[model samples]
Target: RRKAKRGQPPKPTPPPPVPPIEADEQVFAARLRGALYFFSSAKNRNAFLAHPARYANAPPPTSFLPPTAALLGPEAQALPLARTLSRKLGLVVLSLDEAVKWVLQGASPLAEILRPIVESGTPVSPLHQVQALQLRVSSPDTLRRGWLLLGAPVDGKIAEIMRVCSVLPSRIFGICAQHADASIAGLEAALKEKRLSHRLAKIDSSRNPLAQQHEVERVLLPLLRLRQQAVAATAEGEAHTAEGLEVTDDDFVAKLNPKFGFYCPVTWLNERRLHHCGDGEAAVAKRCAAEYKGVYVCCASDKQLSAMLLRPEEVLAGPPLPSPLPTKETQQAAAYGVSPSLWAELSGHCPVTLARGPKLGDYASRALALKEGKKEFCVEYESKRYVMASAECMEEFLATPWKFSRLTLPSKLLPASDPLDVGELPTRGYSEQTLGDSLKAALTDLLTLERPKYPTLSCTETALKFVALHLKANNPNVRAPHLKHKYSSKLHDYTERCGLLDAIMRTARSNGEVAAHSTASAATDATEERDQGRPGPEGSEPDQTTATAAHSESAACKKASEAPMPDLATLFKAWDEAVAAGLDIH
Candidate 1:
C-alpha cells in the first residue's frame, strides 16, 4: 500500500489472494434446464437432481406479500401453517408465544403484568397477549418485509386493541378443525359473537398441507397483485409529476372544448378516472365515418350521464346537437310523454287517432271502430287533433279532454336515451349497440335450438320480454319494454314455429324455481349449522354456505384474475363475449 500526502486520502490496498479449496469441500452446483443453481448441502443438490423437471419450471420464490396478515388457531395447527406461508410468500412470522417470551425477558410494564400468569402456565388474557405481540411487531426490523402473526386468539378484544394500537393485520386466517378443542371452540364463539367471522377466513385443518398452502395462496395472490399494481401506478404517477408530464389544471382546461365539454367513456369505465377527451369531434367523426358507423355519444351533464347510440352514418350526416347542453329536467320534458306541453310542441300539423274512445271504453270495440274507419267526429286539444269514432264520443272527450286523452307516447317517439346513475355507471367498455347485438345473437341461438315451426306473436312477445329483463338487469335506466321493440320486430317471423315459445318459457320458469329453491335451502342449511353450534365450510361466514354462497364469488374472482387488467379494448372484447355467451353481467 502507498502512503498518501497529508491532505489526500490513503491509497487502497489490494486484497490478498486466496488458496484454492479441495474439490470435496467445494460448493455443490448444478444446471437445471437453462439456469444454474447452487446449494449449501449435497442433500438439497441431490433432491433437485432427482426431480429436475419439478424444480425447473417452478416459479422462483418471491418475497412479495400483503402489507399485513395474521394467523389464528391452536399452536399445533397455526405454527406449521405460518411456517408454510412464510416459505411460500417470504413473510416474516411473529408468533405470540415467541413475542410473549421476548416480552417476559424484557422489563416492559406489559411483561411485568404477564410474568406471573405466564410463569404459572395460565393462559394470558387477550389484552396482554395483544400488547406483547404489538411490542414485537412494532420493531422496524420485524416488519421490513410484510409479517404473518401466529397463534393469536381470535378475540374481538385483541382485534380491537390491535386496531387502536394501529397494528391490525390487513387479513386474518383461522385454522378450523372438524372436532375443535375447547380453546378453538372458544375462539370461534368469540368470532361469532363479535360478528368478525367475515374478517377471518377459516382454513380447514384436515386438508393436506399442500392444499392448505394453495387455498391461502389463492386468497392472497390476487390481493398481492392488486396491491402491487396500485403501488406501481402511484410510482408512475409520481414519476410523471417529477418529469412535468402530469396534467396540470391549465392543461386539463385546455383539453376541454369550452363549448361542448369532453367525455371519454373509455377512461371513465375502465379506470374510474375522468379525463378530457383527447380526440375532438372531427377526429371521432372521421374514425366513425371510416368504419361506416356513427359515433355513440356519452354525454355528461349535471348530475346525470347519458349515452345515445346513433344509427350508422348519423354522425357524418345528422345535424349537430344544440349549443349549451340541455339540463336533465329539460331533456326529460322534451321527451314525448304524457306531458301536455310536450304533446303541444311535437303535434305540429300531423293528426293522430284517438285509440281510446270515450264511449267504447273497451279495446276490442275501439279496434273494431278504427278498422271500420269511423272518422265522422274530431276534437282539437293542446294544438293536437284527435280523430274519433262518433260525434257523441267526440263531445264527451271535449267535455273532459284530460280524462280521455291520457295516452302513452308511441314507442318510436320515446327517445332511446339511457340515463346512467353516477354510482351504477357502466364500468365495462361496451357500446349499447354491441351489448344489444350480442344479446340478440344469443337469443337467436337459443331460439334455433328450440326449433320453432313458425314465428308467432306470442313467441315475439316472449323474446321481447327476455331482452327487456336482460337489459334491465344490466342497466336500471331501461324501465320500459318499448326500447327493445325493434329487436322483437326483427325476430317476429323467426320465433314460435311449433310451440317452441312455450317450451322456452317453461325452461326459464323452471330455472327461476330451481335457483329460488337452492337459495332457500342453503339459507336453511346455514341456519341449522349455526343453531347446532358448528362452523360452516372454510372461507365462509357463519351465516353462509361456501359451496353455494362462494360459487358465484369464486367464479367472478377467477375471471378477474385470469383476465388481463382491463383497458378499453380488452374490456369491450370481454364484455362482448360474456354477453354473446348469455352470461350474467355481474
Candidate 2:
C-alpha cells in the first residue's frame, strides 16, 4: 500500500463480504431447496436436514398473532365451544347476548328497541347487534388479550358492519352440529361472499366435545406458537429491566438488633435533622430531652458512638417485635397449618385433597395445596411419595393413580384397573386429564373416612352414590358401566336421609329443556285452536281466560325448572353436614 500525502488521511480498508447463508454463531443454519433455514441448535438443524423434503415448502415461522377469533353458528354449539376455548386458552368469552345485555344496562337508545326481541329470544337486527359488540370489544380488558366471540351473526351484512366498526375477528369459525343447520350454511356463504374463505374453519359439534376442541386447537396451533414466542420475548425483555434495587442496612432502621431492620421512608429521611449529641450517653439523653421529640442515636457501651441524624417519622412507633410479624412465611404457616421445614421440603408438592378440587388446573391453588399435604397419609408412586388427606383419598389414588400424578405416565405404566383406561384417554384431543383429576379429587374429598361418612356404608358404596349423582346431574350422557356393575347391590337404595339425592334429581331438568317444552305446548295449543275455531276477538273473555291460564302455566313451569345443578360450594356444604350427621348420602 502506498503512503498518503502529508496533509491527507489514508483511505480506509473495505470489510470482507458476508456469506449469503450466514447465521448467528449461536444459531444453526442449513440449506434446504436452495433456501437457507435456521434452527435453535445443532440438534434441531440435524433433525430438519434429516427430512428436508418434509420442510422444503413449509410456511415461514410466525412470531406473533392476535388472539381475536369469532365463533358463528347455532347458540347451542357455539356457546359451549367458546367457553371451552376460553378455559383452554386464556381468551375471554364475549357473547352477542352478553353484549346486548350490556347495551340494555347502558343509556343507549337501541336498548329499548332490543329489549323485547331479546326477551323473546329473537335475534336482534344486524346493525344494532354489531354496534353492541363493538362497544364490548372496545373495552380495555377485551382489547388487551382479545376475545372469543360467541353466537356471532353469519350474515354478510353483519360481517361488513363488524369490519367497518374495526371489531371483526382475525379468524372466523363455523360451529356445525353432526347434521349441518341453515345457520352453518349461511356462515359458509357469508365467508365466501366476503372473500374470507381462507380464514374460515368448521368445527363439528356431533363428535365428542373434547374431540371438537382438538380440531379447533389443531387449526390454532400456528397462532398459539406465535403467541408463545411473543410472550417469551416480552418476558426476556422485562428480565433485563425488572431487577430489584440492592437492599442495604442504610435503607432501614433497627430498634434492638440491627439485623432485624425496618424499611425507612425516603420522605422521612429527607426531612430528618442532624445534631451532635455530645460524646457520652448522658449528654445524648440531655440533648434528646431538650429536643422534646423522638430521636435515634447510635450507642456503644452506653456511650454516644455516632452523631447520626434521626427522624421521628422514620422511627417505627410501636414496641419492637409486635404481636404478629408482617411476614409471608409466618402468615402462610399459620393459615395453612404448615411448618417452615415442611414448607421448604414439600413446597413443590400438591396435596391430594385440594388437587382434586375443581380448580385443580390452577397453578396458584396447586402451590398452596402443596404445603397442606400430610405426611401421615402418603403413598409411593413411581418412587415418589405423594401425600393424601385420608385413607379414602389414598384408595382413590390407587384406583386411578394417573389422575393425581403430576407426571404424565406412559400407557404401559398405567394400572390395569384404571377407571378411565390409559388407552381410552384422548391424546391431544382435549383437557380430559384435568377434568378427570378434578372429578377424582371431588369424589375423594366427599368419601374420606372422617365424620360425615355415609352411615353403615362402605367407602366404595359412598363413592358410587356420589359418582352416580354427579354424572346424572351434570353429564347425563356419560355412562360409568364399571361403577354400575360394582355397586349394583347398593344402587337401588335412594333413601333421602341426607337430602343430597333429592337435590340432584330435582336439578336434572335444565331451564332450556323446560322452555322448549313450554314453547312446543303453546304451538300445539295454537294449532288446535286454528283447526277447531277462531278466537272470538283479541279482547274477548274466552281468549283472555285462555291466555291467562297459559301464562300462569308457563310461569309455574319456569319457576320449577330454575333449580340449577349443585355447584361446588353447595356440594361441599351438603357433604360436610351429611358427614357430621352420619346419614346416608344416597
Candidate 3:
C-alpha cells in the first residue's frame, strides 16, 4: 500500500552542474567504485564510505583495469564489469538508504556488491525549502571524493545532496581539507552517475581547526572520525599517525562519542592569550573563532575572562583599554544556539572574578543578566540542581531526570577528619564540591586548638574562646553577648580547667576590686568560692555551690582532652565563629 502523503512528492531537485568529466572526476569515481566493491558489506556503507584516502592503494585488489579506460570512459559506453563484479564478490548490494538501515538492523553479508546509479533524475529537493544536504561516498581510493562533498553548494542541489549524505564515510576520516567555491553542478553530475549517495545527517565541522579557517561549515559539514582499522594499522608505525589519532584520554574521548570534539575554554583561552595581539574585540573574536569555534561558556565571568585575556599588567599599563565584550546580541545568540548551562559552566570556570548582581552601564553585565540571570532557570534532579539552559537538558529534559543529573550519593558520610574524594563531575557541580571542602578545612582548623591542654575548663570552651577571639579580630559584627545570663552560661562550661580563675579571685578580693568591673570576672567566678569557702549575702545563697561542682568540672576537662573533637559545632555555637576562630586556634 502507498504510504499516506501529507504533501506533494518533494519537487525534483536539479542535479549540480557537472565538471567536464575530467581526469580527476574519473579517477575519483573509479576509486569510489573500487571502495564500494572492496568493503561493500550491506551494513557498513558508511564505514566503507569513510575508509581513508591514504588506504586507496592498500592491499592489492583482486581485479585490475588500466586506469585510463575504466575511469575516463563515457557514461553510455560499455563499463568495466570486471572491476564492478569484484565489488559484488566482496559484499552484498543494498540501496543507499538501506545501507544504514542494514547496519542498524545488524545485517551482515558474506559478500559485498557495488550498485552505482546516478540519481540526478530523482526529484527530491525543492528550491523554496532550504534543506540540509549530506553526502556519503564509499570510496577510500580517492582523496577527491571527500572534496566533492565539501564543494557542494550550500543553496544549490548538489550541496543539498552532500548535506543529506553527511553520515557517509570518506577516505579521510580524522582530518580533512575542503574548498568553499567548488560547484554544486559538478556534485550533481557525480550523484547522477551514482558516485555519491545521501547519508542524511549533519556533519560536525567543529573538530577540524581548518574548517572555519576555510569557512567550510557554512557551505558544508566537516567531520573527523576515528577509523579503528586505520588507527590499528598506524599504531606501531608512528607515535601519531595520518590514519587516525590514538585515544589518549579514553574517558574524555568517551564523552565525545556522538559529537566529535569538546571545547575547553581554560586551555584554549590560555593558549590564545599568550599569542593573541590586537584590540580586545579583534583579539577576542579572533581567538574565540580560532580556539573555541563559537562555543559559549557560562562558568567564567566576562571580567574574569577579560582579565585572563588582557592580564593585570596589560590592564594597568593602558588607560583601561576596552576589551571584547560579548554584546547583548551575542549573548542572545549564545543562549539560543549554544548550551546556556554549558556556557555558564564554561564561564563560571573562566579565570575572572566579578562582583555579583547586575549593573546598568556595562554591556556585558546587562547581557549576562538577560541571557543567564533572569532568563536562566534551574530544575531539580536526583536531589541536586542542574542548569536548564544546557544542550543536554534541552535534549533530555523530559526524557530522564536521574540520568541528566548524574548524581551518585555515597552510602555513608565520611569522618570529619577524612577528606571526601569526589571523582570528576559529569555535569557542572565542581563549585559545590570545592565549597564543601573549604568549609571542612575551616572547621578542622578550629578543632585542632584543644591539643595544648590548658588548666582551663573543658577543651570545648577553649575552642569557643579561640572562636570568640577570631570574631573580635576579623569580622566587625560580632560583639559581647547582650544577656548576662547567657554570658554566665557560656563561661560556666570552661571554669573548672582554668585554674587561673582561683588566683584571679584571690587578687580581686585582696585589692577590694569591684566584682563587676574586674578584668577577670570569668576567672574570679570559677574559683572565688573554692578560695573563700563562703556563702553569699545574709538573705541569699552564694552563686558558687559545692565542692562537687569543682569535681565535675575537673572530670569534664580531663575527658575532653582525651577524645578527638568532631566538629566546630561541638565547641562553638555558630558556623561564623568556627571560621573566624579556625585561625585563632591554629
Candidate 4:
C-alpha cells in the first residue's frame, strides 16, 4: 500500500482476523491481575467478559483457572461442594413422592394403582402427591429422621397445604423458592425427553442442579439453627426455634461474601490491590498466593471459601432477616401521610366518580373520559355517592378513598359542565335508589358460586377473604379500600351478613328443608295475624297453626343463629379439609 502524504498520518491496518486455536490450544481464557481476554472475535471475548459463568467449566483438564473461577456459574461446579457439605452434616434427602408412598398404609396398594395410571395416560395427580405428603408428615417417626421432602407439588395448592399445616403450628424451618431464568421450550423439551426415555432428564445442565442444592441448603440452615435455638431457649425461657424465614441461596451467597473480605463491598466483585482491605490486604498478598481456581483472601482462604460457598448457613444464624410482613400499625401510619376528612366534605355532595377521579377539573382544560369508554357500578361513601366505571376500578378506588379523594382521575367534563365551573360534577352516575339496594345488587352479581359449599368457619373473616379471592379471580388488579372508608366497612359488613344467610339458604336447599322453612314461615305469619286480630288485605282470610309452634320455631332459630362467625384461620382450616376431601387422591 502507498504511504499517506507527509502531513497526514499513515492509514491504520484493517481489523485483524480471529486467531484460530490449534488442536492443543485453549479455547477460552481469563486473567486475574487484568481484564479477561479472548483469542477469538471481540464478540466472543465481550460475552465471556460480561459473565464469567458462561464459560466456567466444572473442572479443567489442567489445574490452570482464572481467579474468579468459582463464581455463580455452571452449577456442576457446586456438586463437589454440596457432597462435601452433606457428608459433614450427615443428612438424608427424601424424594417427597417416594417418602409419601413409603409412609402410606399398604404401599403396594398405591403403587399397583398408580403404576397402571402412569403407564396408561394420566400423570400422577398432584393432589394424590399432597395426600401422600399429609400421610408422611402424620407419622411421628418420619419427623424424627434427619430427612427432607422434595419434588411433590400439588398444582396451585401449596398455599392451601401450608395453610393446613399452619393450624398444627407446623415445624417447618424455612422454604427456599428458586426463581430461575429458564425458557418454556427448554423445560418442555426436558420433560418430554424424560417421559420418552424413562430416565433422568436434566433441564438446564448448568442451573438445575445448583437450584436443587440451594433448596437443600435453605432448609438445612434453619434445621441446624433451630437446634441451636432449642439449646438457648432451655435457659432463656423464650421460644428457641425461629420458624418461617424463607431466603434464596443466591442471596445467602451474596451476604456471606461480605464476611469473606475478598470481594468489593460496593460492586460485590473480587477486589484488586490497595483498595478496601487495608493492612489485611497486604498480609494476604504476602502470606497467601492465589493460584488458578483458589482465591486467597484474609477472612477466608481458598479452601475455606470452597467449603463456605457450599454451606454458609451457619454465618446466617440469627436476625438481620430481610422483608418482614407488614403490620396493622404500619398500615395505619401509611394513611396518616395525608389528612382525613368526611365523605361529604371531600366529594362536595357530588357523586364520587372513579372514571373521572377526584382531581377531575384541577389542571387540564376539563375533566375527560379515559381512553376506554365508561363502564358501571355506583357506591356511596357515608352519605355522598361515588360512581366506579367498573367493579374492579371501584374496588381499587374505594380501597384507599383518602388517597384517591385528594387527587383526581384524568377526564373531559360533559359539554354542560363547560368553563370548569366552581362546583364538582353533579350526581349523574349513582342511581336515586337507596345505596344499600344498589350495593347489594352489585355484590349479588359479583358472588358467582353457591353459598352452601362454603366453609362452616367464621363468616366475617372468611367472607372478607372470599370476596377478595373472588374479586381477584375475576380481575387481578382489583383492590379493597382502607378500613377507615365507610364504603369498605359497609361492603365488608354486608358481605358477612350475606354469607350467613347464604349459608343457611344453601343448607336448607340441600337438606330439602326449604319447603319446611317456607311452611313454617307462613304458619308463623298466620299466628302473628291471629294475635294482632287485623283484617286481611282486600277480603282474604288466614289459617292458623298451634299456639306453641311459633314460639318453639322462633326460639330454636334464634339460638342457632346466635353462633359467632368464624375467624380467617378457622375458615382456611375448613377450606383445606373441604378441598382435600374432594380431591381424587387415593
Best model number under TM-score: 1
Better candidate by lDDT, 1 or 2: 2
Q: Pick the lDDT winner.
A: 2
Give the per-residue lDDT of model 1 (tens digit) for 350-433.
122444433445555443323111223434555444544344554444434555455643323323334455555464535443
- Candidate 4 lDDT by residue in tens digits, 11-127: 665433333333323345544234344434446655655654445432443211110000122324433433444465543333445744564434555556666665686766655
lDDT of 3 at 442: 41
- Cα-based lDDT at residue 42, candidate 2: 77
lDDT of 3 at 16: 38
Comparing candidate 1 with candidate 3, which one achieves the higher lDDT? 1
Please give, for residues 412-492, the per-residue lDDT of candidate 3 as tens digits: 322223234566653346646654554454456566533522342466666666455433333334365555445445444
Model 1 deviation from native, Cα RMSD in Å: 38.0
Local distance difference test, each candidate: 0.51, 0.53, 0.32, 0.39
Clashes by residue pair, model 1: 452-497, 453-497, 453-498, 454-497
Q: By TM-score, how accurate is candidate 4?
A: 0.24
In model 1, the Cα lDDT at residue 543 comes to 51
lDDT of 4 at 270: 27
What local lDDT does model 1 show for residue 368?
38
Model 1 misplaced stretches (Cα beyond 4 Å): 1-67, 106-124, 177-198, 238-586
